[model samples]
Structures are given as structure tokens and as C-alpha cells.
Target: MSRPVDRESPDRLYTITSGRSRGGDEVFDAVTLVVAECDPTPGMQSEHSRILRMCQRPMAVVEVSARLGLPVNVVRILLTDLLDAGRITARHPTAVNSAVSPFASPDVLEKVLVALQKL
Candidate 1:
């Protein structure tokens, strides 16, 4: 069943005309229906791609924002969508280990400092 467009949501359904009849008397056209559900806004694809590139490891929202050079709010919105879609997973260090703070690991801290130096 087809429905009217929703103004608030990014999901959209549409039909495309595939081809025409050879005789061309009463043109026969094939209707291809598509249903896409996601943030279809401009630059969303690039944002998703960037997230996928970095999402292999658990990253904070601020880290993603800094890496992508995008505003924190924009990164939050995209992260929310990606999380809802199961494309990415969000993990908190505290959630994983109560005693281990972000700076508790000397090795990890050193690696992060080295990475920052390259930037």
C-alpha cells in the first residue's frame, strides 16, 4: 500500500518509470517502487560514510565531531540516527569498567597523545 509523504520523517517511497513499449502506440511503462528509510538530507551520505570509517572502534560523540570537523550538534544527530539504525555502537569507558577512567591507562593515554601530536 502507498501512503502520503511525511513531512517530519526522512523516510520516502516513490515509483519510477522503467521503460516504454516498442510499438509506442500505448506506451507500456514498468513501475519500480522504492522505499528508503534514513536521513536523506544533503551531506547525510557523506556523514554516514565517515561514521562507518571510524565506527570500527568505540568513539565518543565529541571524538567523532572532532574527527569529522563537524559541529557537535550535527554529530550528535547523525550518531543518534546511526545508533538507531544499528550501524554503530556507542560505548562508555565507565560503563565497561567502573575503576578504569579515561586517563587510567598509560598506554592508551600515550597513544592518544601521539595521535594528537600528528594533528
Candidate 2:
């Protein structure tokens, strides 16, 4: 027999977004960059504060999603609220030439690895 399922454990995405899917007028993509621009305001959720802390270093939407353990769409909704409140700004990443490989040099990779290890 299969083990029983725990139905109420996960904090469902819909609950986090207050039952909303779409964020707002602005659009967000996986690579969209976000930066925290202001302090937490009144009437904000704890998740919003967490998002602000994560965005302080200029993170992409997908990175934020992974770091925060939230779905991309749910993160988008939180980001939208921040955008509307003027607490964060979202912008697209710079375009790269199709012919050029995005990989960094070995030396740079080593430096990055060291830096990440320190973190």
C-alpha cells in the first residue's frame, strides 16, 4: 500500500498570492532583473519582506523563485505588489549576441567559485 498524502502541509501558491495569478499591468520574464529600492511599508506581508531582502543584490526572477522556494508565477505576483508599491524595480537583462558563448573564462570561474564559497 502507498503512504498517505499530507494535504495541508504545503503553503499553496494561490494562498500566497491572495488567490491571484496575474500580478498587474507590467510583465515579468524568468530573466527579468529586480532590485530592492525601499524599506518595507505598512500592510506588507512577511513574504514581501523576504523578497526585498533577496532582491537587494540584483537577482533575476527565476533566481529569486529558487532562493525563496516559491513558484515563478507566485514570485511574479509578489514582485508585482512590490513594483506597484515602489519598493522594488524590475528590468530586463541586457541582450547578448547569439554567436558569443555566455560562459566565463576558467580564471573568472575560479574567482566566482571562491566568492560563492565565502558566501
- Candidate 1 stretches greater than 4 Å from native: 1-44, 95-119
In order, what lDDT does every prediction score?
0.49, 0.80
9-100 in candidate 1: lDDT tens per residue?
Answer: 32311111012112211211111111123323455566676777765655566666677765455455555556566665554443345356
- Which residue pairs in candidate 1 have backbone atoms (N, alpha carbon, C) closer than 3 angstroms, thus clashing? none
Cα error, candidate 1, residue 94 (Å): 1.3
Candidate 2 to truth, TM = 0.67
Which residue window of length 10 is worst by lDDT in model 1?
A: 12-21
Instruction: Flag regions of model 2 displaced more than 4 Å.
Output: 1-11, 24-26, 97-119
Question: Candidate 1, residue 117: CA error in Å?
Answer: 27
RMSD of each: 18.7, 8.3
Predicted candidate 1, C-alpha RMSD: 18.7
